[model samples]
Structure formats: structure tokens, C-alpha cells
Target: MILFGRVRMLLLRTIAYLIDSFILFILVIAGFQSFLLITGLHPFIGRHLYSISGNELHIWLFASIIIPVYMYFVTMFNTRAQATLGMRAARLQINTTGRIGIGGAMLRALIMLVPWELTHIALSYPKPFWVAHHLQSPLLYIALSLTGIYWLLPLLNLHGKSIHDFITGTIIIRWHMPPTKKP
Candidate 1:
């Protein structure tokens, strides 16, 4: 049956998502730092950032974003990753009626990157030229902002769907795994 009250489901789904996103953040950085270094750049924390490669940075950043999307999609679409490492840890999963799509997954990741959304103002894309000298290009911050709009799904969607999920036709459902029947 299609769901009517999406709040509970949305909360569960979001919690699961946070778990996966957190894990993906750690794993992707640990896995890809060396690759970023291969491009003759390294990630460092400081007041003044280093590197001039916007394209390289974009690529690395995209990798970081895409991993979680893929992981989330797998769980949302196939309902497997839902119970995987992150979701299991958080006790969350996909909805029975909701599902994930490739486009939706990508859209969700893209949107989540947006910053300063609570101000209810459009974010201006900063055109920092120095990034190009380091082997990078202008980033699609707007795209991320557009994608970040997904956060409003639970709030905006009476049925509990973010723009990405709405576009993908996926809904967050409170997941409860029934006991398996032994054959």
C-alpha cells in the first residue's frame, strides 16, 4: 500500500542516510587522498588553502559526493544497502513503497553539497580563478545548491519526499524487517 504519513518514514530514512553518508565520507577520503596526491596535490587543513587545480579538486570532490549517492541508491533501490554497515548501525533502511533510481541518487548527492541553505537566499557561485592554475575548473556550486534542495523533502513533502526523491519517485519508509522463513 502506498504510504500517507511520510514523517516517520522520512525520519528513519534520513537517519539511515546520515549513517551511510558519514561512513562514505570517511572511506572515500581515506581511499582517495592518495589519488588526489597523484595529481600533485594533497588535502591539508589551514587558514590559507593550497592547490590551484579546480578541475582536480572538482574531480576529487565529485568522487567524495558520488560514493554516498551510490551507496544510498543501492540501499534505496535494492533495499540491501539499507541494512548494510551504516544503516544497520543506525537502525534505518528503505521504505517498502519507496525506491531509488540512478538519476535520483545522483541528484540527491549533488543537492546535499549545498551550503548556507537556511538563509533562504540563493548562493552565488564563487569564480576563483586561482583554482584553474592548479588543474581544476569552476565548480558547480549552484548545482550542489540545487541538489541541496533535497533537504526540504521531509519538510515540504506532505508525503515525505525531497526534490531528488520526488524526482526519482522514491519515498522514505520506516523499515522493519520481518523474520525470515527458513526453507
Candidate 2:
């Protein structure tokens, strides 16, 4: 029964993450479209921003995605509910051993994003000049391994805690909101 609960929690977490990722994807597309419109309207801004090397473009794109996602995680975790929209949808909450302040939330968010960002780097080919600077690229293997380990971590434990949760001394658990009082 305990193992089953853990498995269910892990599945819920996975679904929650997918939901959040989808939301972020939409937001990123909308943001880029907005930027394109602004740039199209003003050639000067477009010229300055658009004029970048291929490698630099990749970095900029990554930053654009990472920055927003990082901020979202940090903000959501630091909130009273300590859950993102997806987490809420999945009825999940963060249970922290200590006060998980802004700094802790930031660290947790960054750690959680590491495997994902690494996978992106590994998959994006023609190897951005900086990435392919080395004679041999071990990034793909590292990325795949890390991603698999991170994703499988919850299964190894009963509480469904992943690498980020362990690193930050936090746990993700099923939760429910209390009933509101009548006016």
C-alpha cells in the first residue's frame, strides 16, 4: 500500500511537471512573438538584438527559457501554498524541513532545471561552437544519464523525493486545502 501511494505520487508529480512545462512553453512562444512584433515595428531594436552569432543565439534562447522558468519556480515555491499551478492541479505541496526561503527556493529551482537544460544542450546539434570546442563531446551521455537518474530518483524512495528535493531538504507530498469558513 505504501509503495503504491509512492508510485501514485510520483505519477502525479510527473503529470504536474508536464502541465507546468506546457504552460511555460506557451508563455515562451507568446513572449517571443511579442518580441518579434516589437522588433518588426522598430528596426533599430531588431537590428541590435537580432545581430548575433549562432552560438550567441543559442545562449540567448536558452536564457530566455531558463530565466522565466527559474523565476516561476522560485516564486511558486516561495508562496504560502508552496506549489506551482501544476502542483496545485495535482494536489501537491512542498514539505520543507526548515524554512525554504527565497535563496533555498532559487537553489532548488536551479538544481531541478539542470538535467533538463543539459538534455537540451545534448540534443541541439551542429554543436554550438562553444559546446563543440572540445575534441570529444561527452555531454550527450552525461545529459541522458543525469536526466534518467533524476527522473528515476523518486522511485528509489518511499516519499517520492527527487534529487532536487533531497539536495534542498524538501519533500513533495499529496495535499488538500482546508475548507473555507462561512461568511
Candidate 3:
């Protein structure tokens, strides 16, 4: 049975996410180091190798980071576990019958990706760059707003389904153990 209330669910999910994030951070660092080694470039040498101002390079960098993460989520969600490592640690499962298809998994992964990528971009990129490039204020504002909403939406829903859950037609449910009788 599903055990956790919204608060517990949220807390568990947060813990799980932190654990997963830490793991991914390590992977990202390793990947960066590998890239540097393979290309024989100093850490600061390839400053322009993938500039944010260049569309192709920007897309490539985004894709390079996103694709592996996307595959990780999709593969885990589609597995018998039906949960990522974080979800498993939280004792949360994707409440669905049968396996979530590749398309569904991809959609869910992408939905989760948007807010994450947007917030990273908003925080990492300078405002002056956007202004100079005519990207305008609303874009950053929207990204920030959406990032806020993405987290808060779970609280608004009866079942604690976030925006991504709703968009991907997925639900998160917690596992519960039956009570034991005192001897």
C-alpha cells in the first residue's frame, strides 16, 4: 500500500534526488576530465570550443549532457523497478500497470529535463549576454517561474503529481509495510 503523505513523500523524494544528483555530479566531473584528456586540452584552453553564443555548439553541449541523463532516467523508469535509484531509495514507485513504453519514458524524461535545464541555464548564463543578444527579460523570468512552479506543483495536486507527472501520465506511490502486532 502507498504509505507516505505529501510531506513525507516530498522529503523522501528530496533525499533521493540529492543522492542521485551527487552521483551524477561525479559522473559529470569524470566526463569532463575524460574530454580534456582525450583532446589534450588544458582546462581553460577550450573556452571557445563550445560557447553558449554558438547555436550548434550550444545544442551539442546541451545534447551531450542531456542524452545520457535522459537515457538513465528512461531506462530506470522502464525497468521492473519502475523507479530510478533515488525513487527506489525513497521507496517510491511509478504507479502504473505494465511497463511504461519507450515513448512514455522519453516524454517523462524530457518533461523532467526542461525545468532542470532551464534553471541551470538561467543561473549559469549571465543576464548581460541575454540582453545583448536580444533574448529579452521574459525568457529568463519564465524559466525561473517555471522552475518554481515545477517544484510546487506536486503540493497543489491531490496525489502529489508534479507537472512532469501530469504531462507524462505518471504517478508516484510509496510502499508501505503492514503493522506488526506487539507480543
Candidate 4:
């Protein structure tokens, strides 16, 4: 029974994450297009944007993904809902043992960004760098390991709390809405 419940929760969480990711992707694309148009570079946008490399690519990734993701998580986590759209859809809520102020939420968001930023760093390097390093990408290895640890910690905890939760003193739990009184 416990195992089944765990699996169900896992599936819900995965679906929620996918939905959130899709939303973010759409927002990023729209923002990118809008930027190009506003800057009068629409004509040079589409295919050329795909060929961006080096510092330009880094800037784009940081601006479009990192900052937006950080802000999204921080805002969602700190709100009355205490969950992102994904978590809410999955019937999950963030609960802190003690009061977690804006600083706590921001720290949690920053810690959550570690694996993502590390993976980006590993992948953003030039192809030649990987080849020269004999394909032994330390950053990639570390990022993957950390990602696994972050995810696996939830399974180890009875409350479904992850590493980020431990660090920030927050936990994710099933949300139950209060019943309304009949008028």
C-alpha cells in the first residue's frame, strides 16, 4: 500500500514538472521573440539565434532560463499557495517547520539551481574542450551525481522531503483544502 502510494505521488510529481517545464519553455520563446522584435532584429532572429555560441549562448541561458527559473520558484514558494503551479497541480504544498522568510525561499531556490547550473556549465563548453579533456567531464559527472542525490533523498525520507528541504527546513506534503461551510 505504501509503495503504491509512493509510485502514484511520483507520477503526479513528474507530470506536474513536465507541465511546468512546458510552460516555461513557451514563456522563454515568447520573450525571446519579443526581444528580437523590440530590438528591430526580427529579420536576423530565427536561424541566426540557433547558431549562437560562446558568451552569447551563456548570456542567453542565464537570462532566459536561470533567472526566470529562480524567480519563478522563489515567487511561487513564498506565496500563500506555497507551491509552484506544478506542485499545486500535483496536490502538493511546501511546509516549513518554522517560519521561512524570503531569505529562506531564495536560499532554497539557489540551492535547487545548483545541478541545473552545473549541467549547463558542463554542456556549454566548446566541443573541442570535451574532446581535449578525453570526454571526462567532471562538471557533468558532479551535476548528475548531485541531481541523483537531491531526488533520492525524498525517497529516503518518510515525509517526502528532499535535500533542498533539509537545507531550508521545508517539506513538501499533500495539500488538503478546507471544506466550505454551507450557507
Q: Give the candidate order by descending lDDT.
A: 2, 4, 3, 1
Error of 1 at 105 (Å): 5.7
Can you write out model 3's per-residue Cα lDDT over 107-147, one digit (the tens) per residue?
88888878666644654454324334425546567777887
**By the TM-score metric, which is better: model 1 or model 3?**
3
Model 1's alpha-carbon lDDT is 0.49
Model 4 is weakest, by summed lDDT over 10 consecutive residues, at: 126-135
Which stretches of candidate 4 lie above 4 Å from their native place? Answer: 1-4, 30-53, 126-136
Task: Estimate the TM-score for candidate 2.
Answer: 0.80
| Candidate 4: tens digits of C-alpha lDDT, residues 85-165 | 989988887788755678888998899889998877676665323233524678889998998887676666666666778
Residues 1-183, model 2: lDDT tens digits: 277777888899999999998888788757764786667842234455334454554565576777878899999999988888999999998988766889889999999888777655654444554445533447767877888888888888877789999999999877877899999
- CA lDDT scores, all candidates in order: 0.49, 0.78, 0.69, 0.74
Q: List the residue pairs that clash in candidate 3.
A: none
Clashes of each: 11, 0, 0, 0
List the lowest-lDDT window of 10 residues for candidate 3. Answer: 126-135
TM-score of each: 0.53, 0.80, 0.74, 0.79
| Residue 154 C-alpha lDDT in model 4 | 64
